[model samples]
Structures are given as C-alpha cells and as structure tokens.
Target: METDSDVELAVRPAPHPWLVLREHAHLVPMISLGGALGALGRWGLAQAMPHPAGAWAWATLWTNLGGAFLLGLLMSCVLTVWAHTRYVRPLLGVGVLGGFTTFSTAELDTRGLVAAGHPGEALAYVATSVALGLVAIMLGLGLGSALLRRGRPRRVTP
Candidate 1:
C-alpha cells in the first residue's frame, strides 16, 4: 500500500536541467569578464617582474597575497553593503580573485626550489607565503569592515 507521502513525491515532477542552467546563465558572462581582466593583470605583473626557476617567486607570492586581501575585502562588502548584489560575489570573489591567484604556480615554484638544492629557501618561501597570506586576508577583512562602519551614518540619541 502506498503512503500519502509516497503519492505526493511521485506526483511532483523534477525540474529540467536546461531550466536550471538558464536561471544561472547570466552569471557566466560576468565571471568570464572578471576572469579575463584578472588574468591580464596577473600576466602584466609577472611580465614586469619575471623570476627564474629555483628562485623566490616574489611575483606569485605578491599576486596570491593581493588576491587573498582583495577576496576578504570583497567578502565584507558583499555580506554587508552589497548583500543584494547577486553577481558581485561570482564576478569578483570567484572569477577575478580566483584567476589572479595561482596555487599551481606556487607549488611548481616550491618544487623547483627543492629540485635545485635550495630546500631551505623553498621552506622559507612556503612558510612566509602561507603566514603572510593569512595575515593579509585578516587585515583586509578588518579594514574593509572598519571602513564600512565609518561610512555608515550613526543615529542620534534623544
């Protein structure tokens, strides 16, 4: 014997995949544009400050740190000031910042340093990058939030 719950479940039709895709179709272009702009910025930075193999990847380190900072700031804005702005997070946080930060390149650089008999430098690079990245993100979040607070109008007490 079929229960009422079973009957209800059977009566409800599943949503079509195309409809789901169409709902989020607008986000694709925003992400794409942000990613392209970020990639170009990163490429320009790398070109300006080229680093050879087995050396400290200053460019990658700075790029990742900058991205992390920006992501934190963007998140603060998104959660507070831009809460209703649907595309802001996808465009800036996921696309632009994602493209700007290169984890693979950082790993490759670390490996190259290790292979080149500079294990100490590799360890230092990795440690400093991770530590600094964390600090940078925290700083970004704090600064963004503080700036937002300052900009907000305070209510006067009677």
Candidate 2:
C-alpha cells in the first residue's frame, strides 16, 4: 500500500555532500588564515624551546595545554558573548587550536621516552600532561565566566 506520505518520502532527493560544503564555503578563508597563524606560533615555540629526543617536550606540552585552555575560554565566550557571531568557532576553535595542538607529536614524544628506556618518565609525562591540561581548561572556563560577569552592568531594584 503506497500512501501519499510514503510516495513523497520515496521521491524526495538526498542532499549531495558537495552542496553541503558549498553552503559553508565562506568559512574556508578564515579557517585557513587562523590555522596558518597557529601553526606558525607553534613552530616558533618549538624553535624557542627545543628538547632532546628522550627529554620532556616542554614546547609541545605547553602548546597543548595552552590550546586546551584557549579552547575552553573561547567556548565560554562564544556561548555567552558571541553567540550570534558566525565563523568564530570554525576559525579559532576548529582551525587555530586544531592546528596548534599536536596529539601525534605528544605520542611520538612518549614513544621516544619509552624507547630510551625511560618508561617511568614517559608515564609521568603522559599523566602530568593530561592532568594539567584538564586543570587548565577548567581554569580558563572559570576565568572567562568571571570576566563576563564583571563586564556586565548589574541592575539595582529597591
């Protein structure tokens, strides 16, 4: 039994992936620019604080932690302050922070430490990075919320 609703559903065309991409094509430039700048900043940090193969990768550690904090802060601002602004998330969150943070490099650093017969150091590094990254995000979110509250004008009713 082919009802009118069933016929309409069967005749409806599925959206092409290309059309979906085209709809948000305008964000490409912002994301690309942000990503480039983030990568450059990460590279500069690495250059400034280069470590040996088996040593703690301070540069990568700081970069990841910083990126995580910034992401949390940015999300808070986006939700509370810039809720209506388009492209901020795609540019800063998806692009800049995405480019700045390097999980692959972190994994490689851990592997290097393990290969150099420092399993304990590797474990400690991983644990410390995860713990500190989480703490950093929480701090960032709290700071962002506090700043927003401070900036707002309070209403007084007597």
Candidate 3:
C-alpha cells in the first residue's frame, strides 16, 4: 500500500524547467529592474567606502547581512499573505536582495585577505559573515511573521 507521503508525492506535479520559466516569465522585467537598482546601490556604497585588499571590508559585510535580513522579512511577509502576488518575490527577493548580496565579492574579499597575509582575519571574516547573516535572516523572519500574525484576526469557533 502507498503511504501518505507517497500519495502526496504522486499527487504533486514534478517540476519542469519550461513550465517554471513560463510561469515566471512575467517576473523577468521586474527582477531586471530590481537587479539594476540593487547593483547600482551596491556600487554606490562600495564607492563611498572603498577598502584595500586584505583589509577588513565592513561595507560588504554590512550589505550582505542587511540584504539577508531584508530578504527574510520580504519572504516572510510575502509567504504569509502576499504570496498571490508574483511581482513581490521576483522584484524584491530574487532581484534586489540577490543582486545586493554578492557571494563573488565575498569570495574575492576573503581571497584578498588571505593573499594579503591576513589569513586569520580572512577566516574570521568568512565565519562571522556566514553566522551573522544566518542570524539576521532568522531574526527578520521571526519579526515579520510576528507582526503579520498580530495584525491577523483570530478565528472564533462556536
């Protein structure tokens, strides 16, 4: 006999690349706009706070952590009630936040730090970035979920 999990698996449609792309076609432009804005913002910030190779890069750390938090908050709110809207996720989460958080830059920073004879700092920076980023995201998610739940009306059963 098929188990409940098996039944659910059978009932669910398997993901197809073409179908996924078609479904999200409308989001392309929204994501593109958000990405452009996000990248520009990051570039502006980096310009404002230029750091040498192998030094502590505060701007990037802040940007990534901030982006993670915002992404979490946006996702929480969207998943809770605004999930029906297609624009929000693509515009904010996939486009803005994704573009804002640069793993490539992070890798470059770490590599530079190591190459600059600051392996200890490089290790610390990487560890702290990942750990704090996760914490920030969770915190934002919790706060957003709580706020949304508070605004929702409680159900009454007779």
User: Using Cα atoms with residue i matched to residue i, what is each candidate's TM-score against the true structure?
Assistant: 0.84, 0.85, 0.84
Measured with C-alpha atoms, the lDDT of residue 55 in candidate 3 is 92
Q: By TM-score, highest first, what's the ranking? A: 2, 1, 3
RMSD after Cα superposition, model 1: 4.8
Alpha-carbon local distance difference test for all models: 0.89, 0.91, 0.88
lDDT of 2 at 1: 71
lDDT string, candidate 3, 1-158, tens digits: 75676445546768998999898788889999999889988888788888987899888998899998998899799987887986888898888888888867988999999999999999999999999999999989998999998999999999
At residue 117, candidate 1 shows an lDDT of 98
Stretches of model 3 off by over 4 angstroms after superposition: 1-23, 153-158
Clashing pairs in 1: none
RMSD of 2: 4.5
Per-residue lDDT tens digits for candidate 1, residues 62-94, read 999999899889889998999998899989987
RMSD (CA, Å), each prediction: 4.8, 4.5, 3.6
Candidate 3 clashes between residue pairs 3 or more apart in a chain or in different chains = none
Error of 1 at 139 (Å): 0.5
Kindly indicate the candidate among 1 and 3 with the higher lDDT.
Answer: 1
| Clashing residue pairs found in predicted model 2 | none
lDDT of 1 at 128: 84
Q: How many clashes (backbone atoms < 3 Å, residues ≥3 apart in a chain or on different chains) does model 1 have?
A: 0
